[model samples]
Target chain A: MRDPFRSICDDDLERRWIWISLILAFAMGGLLGLYAVASNIHPPSNVETIDSSRLHLTEEFAEDKLGVKQNDDGSLTVTMVAARYGFFPPVIEVPSNTPVKFRIASADVLHGVHVPFTNATAMIVPGYISEINTSFPTAGKYSFLCNEYCGLGHDSMWSRLIVVPESTQGK
Target chain B: MNYSKAASLGLANMWVAFTFFAFAALLGLYQVIERIDLIPALKSPEMYFGSVSTHGVLMGFVLTTFFVAGFGYYTATTSLKQDVWNRPLAWFGFLLSLSGVLMAAVPLLTGNASVLYTFYPPLMAHPAFYIGATLLVVGSWAWCLEMVMMLATWKKANPGETVPLAMYGTTTNAILWFITSLGVTSELLFQLIPWSLGLIDTVDVGLARTLFSWTLHAIVYFWLIPAYIVLYTLVPRAAGGMIFSDHMGRVAFIMLLVFSVPIGFHHLYMDPFHAAGWKFLHMTGTFMVAVPTLLTGFTIIASLEVAGRLRGGKGLFGWIGALPWNNPLVLAAGLALLMLTFGGFGGMINASYAMNTMVHNTQWVTGHFHLIFAGTTVIMYFAAAYYLWPKMTGNALYSTRLALTQLWLWFIGMLVLTLPWHQLGLAGQPRRISSTPYDEELVQSWLPAEFAMIAGGVILFTSALMLVFILLKTHGNSQSVENPEVEYAESLHSTQRMPHLMNSFGFWVALIVVYMVASYGYPILQFFLLDTYGTVPWSI
Candidate 1:
């Protein structure tokens, strides 16, 4: 009997499958690339590191300077610290219809912050800063949730994000 | 060669794996109910997180590592037509790994290691937990050595003859594991163990996480490869046909090995440490691993297509219907492939850098993994056990009917449970929460999904118990088979004279080393160069 194992079309079929699969995979990659580059929005990947132990002593994340402050560039910078059980500057008050840039860092361990039903999310790893930029279109009350499992009180690790009207910023 | 020695060893390892699996499954059921906060008596955060940690460890590490090593031993011996290269070492490895499991279990079961299976530090576990985990991986290294040595010995004796695909896969996995495990073992040895033991006062969190990401993603592929091996080598024959493409299977296995190791930075996409360039690099590499999965899907379906047509089915869709559904292995492939389809879709979303934000660290991540690991991967583990039990035990299975029923329940349980979790994740439910005591409206909205998950959990627990019962009954089964050792499906074509690149490992290993250095070199090195602060361990 001829070696039936020496059959045709097995490699041929597989070669074609490889091409098709590769094409399919790259197409998805291309689409995601286009969305990332074209839309210019993505998960925060800024590589800024800060000594978390000295976060309160730092100029950028100083305890006195925490929470939303108007930048010289006419944008809002919300500097918050993610400690074990809660976010620092516990309830943030930001003006809606303005660009808000968050500079979050973990004071202890690791934590993640996510604004529900929005693309505003980041993992706050210790020894680094989480810088995410977003804008709230309308005045509303939202929450900054600790999404990562930090410690025992992670269940209650949430604070209010009260987005008030731009005119009511001082209030 | 006394193959029964390999069989007995495999059986012993498998029983230990199932014991952990059953306990973990019960924890899984408790977790679903606990998170719902329905029964006030079950509302303890410490208990909940401890259960979650133990559940993840038992299911993810203890069950998979034990089962894969056991199955590999069986495959190595039978496919190579040789006894294990060092039987005493194999037994020694088994005992060491088991001891590690027990040692780790002490901390995990007692709420001291509620860090979850990810073991994110400076969230400290008991020193024993880290030590035990290290010992477990180290023990598995012994099996890896045995696998490589046995295959090398066989090749030397055979001289340019094709390596059997099953043995090829087992060896590839062994080598893949040796490479894959280096990252975690380093993390354990250099950082976690020392920090937990008070040898080191603090740890660089960014550096620790970067080291972990190296092992995190590939470890999933480690759990998954044994299932793929069974699919490529055994399922087609059980369904009444040969492998549609044996050569493709080898290439697929190689791709899984090479691509899986370097792409783990995708897990760190949402984190603050890595910059955009490196994350983007890992994301693309992550997408590259998907190709092998697609290839495996095509090859297996094609093989089944042949089997169905050989059994007198016709047309594009008719063959699916004609498959030997009564056969447990065949039924499993059908269900496993179906789950893989959905799980693969979820994986693509996770791989895409932009889309990963939507599901990252949410219940969707949890759901996606359970579907792949529990739904696609573990189901196949069940089928492999069912298929191999009679051959290993010298007795026919007590009830094939019960086995079939068990599989369906597992499938149903996974879908019903995980589908709602995706919904909850989208609605902004974070993973690893002990309870949903959040905004009343938000908590209320998640109620229906939580209830559905509890139902799913009950069904899954029922299915798990059924699996354990069946295995136990099979051992005591009276009807014995004449030939306990059975040969399985052949590939459509011989792999002799395939390109040396396809068969060899040296080239692949070197390529992955270059790839890993390129992907991770700067990201990890920055910790030393930059003013990164280390932290002392934190108590929960």
Candidate 2:
């Protein structure tokens, strides 16, 4: 009221709007920060990089080894290769109620995989490795598919994940 | 009036922008139909990918770049009442950019560059595409130079004068463009061109993505600034009211420049090339950028409220009704703000550190951008054209009724097109796919919403055609308006005794430089320091 020439924030409406905007921004930051902390409760975070071109020759991602492996610690690690049109071992069987880690590498180009309606998703970029960890609580067959456009045959780039009851795991 | 050069420049560039917009709208229609498998004849993967890629490139690059540059030239001349600094150099830039666009079109149309608008590596495009894209950006650099020089020249002649708000926003956009484009230009010149030309055997995909992310998000703000400029400078006057605050305009522009450039890592949230910590850091910065947009929404609305109230409006919400719906720019500003609200909400969901996984590369992402870019941003471009076209040609608009009709159609059409997209994405449909060859049963659930989207696309295409038709008819119209001088709205508050920070570019520009290095410097360097490997290109 004293000085209209100084700044517009002196106006009541402007001040209220500024406060509202700042509060919304801070609320957003806070929510994202909270998500960051909560989601990190899982032990592993993926910064792992492997030679994408040599995945087939590697001991870890060799064709024979590209499926579910029951670790001594009881967690399952699924090593897979995402090439142009398909994931290696196209089908994998895992036990429900067990934590599983997927270490996927793109043999060529860029690819993304997602098990729809679930968070088992990652971008499979060549020259780097993608690792995602989660547990399937319900026993069922999930259509795992590549969501990114890697090539012309990208539509065919899909696989199946079968999560069996933990009681039937040995069979 | 000595604005003949400015008018000619604006007309030429805007026509090019709209021409591409019309073509892209047709491709957009085809894309939706193709995606839904609505037309069996459009099932060819080659054509589908080619059309999608072209649609993205044309709308994102060709339309936005040309339109912004055109809008900026007219704004600078009109607002500052100064001659363009260098007419010959300016035209040269326009030609160079046009030639570059034409060169890139060949491969894109032929499906040889189906990598989409993103210059992602490990999947390469024809070398001509990269080279042509580089030339286009380089040519725009000439405009950037001219903008800088023009503003500097104007300031020198009148030392104490605050830069006219319209030109102020334009020059800021120019500087923003220069800084942000460097990221992608470097990626194209050093990494993509060499590989596409076969001068190199393999390219590191990580580094390529990290670099592209540098340009990815910021470029949207660059496209968006012109729209905001129209809102800040043109809309209030168009609605018959004073601007709420010119200082808020400067603050928002500076914030857009400073925060937008450094926060691009939000695009790389899912990509493993960057660390999660870096992505989170960028996510925070992403939210920071929204502050400007929020402020913008308030200021623009306040200005319109003032207009409505000044026209004898009373009570709390009565002003909204009092505002002229016949005035194309006012109606557009109202609609643009509405879409921005929807689009901005979707952006918040996408920017959340964790929620992005659900929508990343999904139809939700696609819908979000279409609303923001096509709905919120492009609608304003339409208003600017309607407002500027008549002035540029010294003719009355062919039909104000048709102009209002076109704006209404575009608004309704965009809502129809994008709202269903969020539904499809929520149902777990991915983006950029030519067809859904999923489990027939799962896809069955997606068909209804997708069919709705195709309808939306058709509406948008028709509206786009109407726009081109209206502009063309206006060009040939015999009637002329009495006053053709450009008029930006005056502020409710006096702009004198301004803060030193708000008046000058030095502090903000320097702050952006430091912010960029701090945000992007080490994340890019990590690829080299780590055991990163280059991969051979994979062509479809």
Candidate 3:
């Protein structure tokens, strides 16, 4: 009588096929990881934290510097706040074809920043700052929405990213 | 072996599980319709969120728990050829869990606990909700203990014999649940309960989320292992073939237990509570866990191929056509593997550190989970029930044709429901929302998909009703029938001389503890160590 619980591990042909499948699967995974890293399409690594309750009173997130700003190094920095109902600076303007660093945090609860058409996304949690670096290649309107469920108003929590052409400087 | 007591207990638990499943399916249809804004009367965001929360808990917690317990009872009794070690204690567990479900249902239905299933603070639910959820977890722990004790007692009696594969798989899941559940147990007992009762002024949302992440991803496996067990133990025999590899089955089960628990930080990839380094570490673990699933797929397919070949299959792929497709268990397994392929790909994308940004928290995530959980896992549950119901009740199935129809409807409905959800996620539609009145142009593109989903939900709801009707009719029917018994798959080679590591779990349990500590210790401790800010509780 044959054992019903036996395996094909002992069969040479089947063993070879199993090895091939395992290797192919892992290789595919490896390639995807490599592409993500080489393309700079990954989660941000800049670790920064802040006091969530006092975000509005801070220097960087004060009423003046809460949106997009042209930095001294010819790069753009966009600072945004995610609250209960919507994102602060419901619309932001950045120059296309230039690197843009987004500095984001949640004022109340946990939210996520997802620019649907692009690879610029990160979590917005209270007491911690999330930063992502990416640049828009084309001048267009892109909508960034809260991906995490916050409350009843989570659906209404969205903002617009208007990437103007680099030729439209200081307009 | 007289299994009357065990069969009755199993029947009772499964009946409760199916009832909750039917209720949840109705709520699921209503949700899809409401999201499309088709009916004005069902358009309340308050009611919608309440229904969503209840739907999630009923399906995620109630149905899976009760069904797994019932399945475990039947598996233990049949596989080991012994009565359940502690019958009275099993009943106690069932009653306790049922009471917990009732306690939680009040707040969940009345909109007092509309925090969604995650129940992250500071969106607190009523204290009763937290207490009820706690009781439910505790009751499940009783089943865990019973499984482990049964295995231990059996091993002691038969000193050198290998434990049965079904019993081994059940015990593995039992240990995994005990460990996987501790995270949520701590969160409920310490943070949510205190804040909900006004005993605490503020709750640390960061800590709450961190702890929840510990349980979130692993709990999916707790729901899914039984499905996998059925695939390995029953599907092959049902198809008239032996399992291709019993050792591989043990290997897969062990890998699942070891790798699944420590990889949960991937759920927090978009959350701010954990550092990128920790998230990346967990991402690697998440990718590693996919190996066992891949192995299981290979083993099951190989088993089927062998079965087909034995049935006069010819050529390279002729085996596929030769195997039985009409049997519900075999058909469901085939459909399940199909869904697993697509769902597994989606999971890899979500688990990737960089690619996660593309679909994070979008309807893509929702679609991915539904494909895996509802499509792959629950379908197997239905197959297992269909296969087991007749045996447990000592009656013929009401209608094999209806069962087959129900299975096909579920598979088609799932594809219809989830495929568009993936597209909507790419189109910028956010999930967990009552309405998507965002950009009107973007929202317009999603309208077709939403309508299709409602149609799919209706099909699924009808299928759910049919399933319950068949089970009830089968139970009540008076037609005399042969007393059928469970027939587990056999292996081509003897498993009497298996390696010690494959035969025991003592080392695996110790390894899991060390791995969890290494992965989660610092991430959770930083909240207490640092002066993390807290938020006031906000209840509905």
Report model 1's TM-score to 2 decimal places.
Answer: 0.97
Q: Model 2, residue B84: displacement in angstroms?
A: 0.7
Clashing pairs in 1: none
Ranking by TM-score: 2, 1, 3
Model 3 ranges with Cα > 4 A deviation: A1-8, A21-25, A32-41, A45-47
Candidate 1 residue B179 C-alpha distance from true site, Å: 0.9
Taken over the whole model, the C-alpha lDDT of each candidate is 0.88, 0.87, 0.86
Candidate 1 DockQ vs. native? 0.62
Determine the backbone clash count of candidate 2. 0
Report clash pairs, candidate 2. Answer: none
Winning candidate number (lDDT)? 1
Worst 10 residues of 3 chain A by lDDT: A1-10
Task: Score candidate 1 by lDDT.
Answer: 0.88
Point out the worst 10-residue segment of candidate 1 chain B by lDDT. Answer: B494-503
Docking class of 3: acceptable
lDDT of 1 by residue, B1-540 (tens): 567899988998899999999999999999998998899998999999999999988998899999998999998888889888999999999999999999999998889999988998889999999989988999899899999999899989988888888988898899888888899899999999989988889999888889888889999999999999999999999899999888888888989989999988889888887888788888888888999999999999999998999998898799889988988898888899999999889889889898777788889988999999999999999999998888889899879899999999999999999999988998889998988767887878888998999999999999999999999999889999666775667887766667676666889989999998998888889889987789889987
Q: Model 3 reaches what TM-score against the true structure?
A: 0.96
lDDT of 1 by residue, A1-171 (tens): 443323323565676778788989888878877877898866798888888888878988888988888878789889899997899988988888889899998888899988877778899998889999888877887777899999888999998888888887674
Superior by TM-score: candidate 2 or candidate 3:
2
